[model samples]
Target: MAKTDQAKADKKRQQDKERQRAKRQRDAEKNSSLGIREYRVTLSQTEADALTDLCAYRGGVEPYGAAEFIATLIRRDKQRMEDEKAHLGTCDFCGEPLPTGCKNGLGIPRLKGVEKCFYTRDEKKLRL
Candidate 1:
């Protein structure tokens, strides 16, 4: 009886160690770039279907499926923003070099959701 109890205890310990090891592996993978996460967004059924369809259009911009395509598209947009900074707008109140430069007169007049540009103290004082 004593021997059987000891064996059961050993088995439980081994199982626990294996579970911990697997958990660590999962955590490491999540921290890596290739890790996966859940993202929720609202869309009409038609839009959802369109997105699923678009995923097949390319050989898949990435190694994964539709999620990767969405990620790639987001990355592409951000890259385009940085690369095409000349097209951005500047802050009217601050006169700072806006993200993508200014558009229209006085450069957008300070938008709520727009990315702001960096301007020197002198630029702010210019009143331009």
Candidate 2:
């Protein structure tokens, strides 16, 4: 009975190790192609306050809570952009050239690298 218990413990340890290894591999692959950003700026107190207010007004979010909210917003936006790119490989409607994504008709802001489609009736393709 002791030997069987030991065997089970070893199997669990091996499985844990395998899971950790796979996780590390996935992380490495994801980070391998990631880009690094660098920038520098100096702001006076008044300028900072004004900027904060502007960002809040423009983003419809509070500047004081920005750090946490921005992280989540950025992550969500990145995922949304990736999903959009995947879906727009071709036009979502009429199977025409996406050129980019169809604007349909909503006045959505265009992201960099996106092309405006000219042939779709999708509301998402408006104002192209």
Candidate 3:
């Protein structure tokens, strides 16, 4: 009985060591500079159906699937935002549109009466 208990303990320790090693490996891979970050999102039934439909439509043309479709949408939105920001005279530092009274190149206003930029305000809120 004593030998059996010792053997069980040793097996448990070995399993724990293996688990720790695997966790460390996963952490290293996740933090690697070249690794692609993954995001998990929860969607409502209707939203999931819409995404599926969009993927199916693209499937008729090629092998484009849900991930590709989502990526394309994100890229399109980013481009649109960049164009809008350029048209609105976006600031170099914050990538936000310059306020009407902004004299400095920075989107942030130095004038006492001028309000803070939207990005700055949001950042402040996050900090708090």
Question: Which candidate gets the maximum TM-score versus the true structure?
Answer: 3
TM-score of each model, in listed order: 0.44, 0.29, 0.47
| Candidate with better lDDT, 2 vs 3 | 3
Candidate 3 per-residue lDDT over residues 12-93, each given as its tens digit:
9999999999998888787786676667989999999988888888778675677888888889888876665566565445
lDDT of each: 0.64, 0.59, 0.67
Model 3: weakest 10-residue lDDT segment is 119-128
Model 1 residue runs over 4 Å out of place are 1-29, 32-37, 60-64, 86-95, 100-128
Q: TM-score of the candidate numbered 3?
A: 0.47
Show pairs that collide, candidate 3: none
| Evaluation by lDDT, superior candidate among 1 and 3 | 3
TM-score of model 1 relative to the true fold? Answer: 0.44
Best by lDDT: 3
Model 1, total clashes: 6
After TM-score superposition, the amount by which residue 48's alpha carbon in candidate 1 deviates from its true location, in angstroms, is: 1.2
Could you tally the backbone clashes for each prediction?
Answer: 6, 12, 0
Where does candidate 1 clash, by residue pair? 85-100, 88-100, 88-101, 89-101, 96-119, 98-117
Model 2, 1-128: lDDT tens digits are: 99999999999999999999999887777767685332355779997787677667756643445454455657878887677666655654334435444434454423323443334234344322
Report the C-alpha lDDT of model 1 over 36-112, residue by residue, as the tens digit.
66689898999988887777776455434767778988888878766655553555645545542343355553343
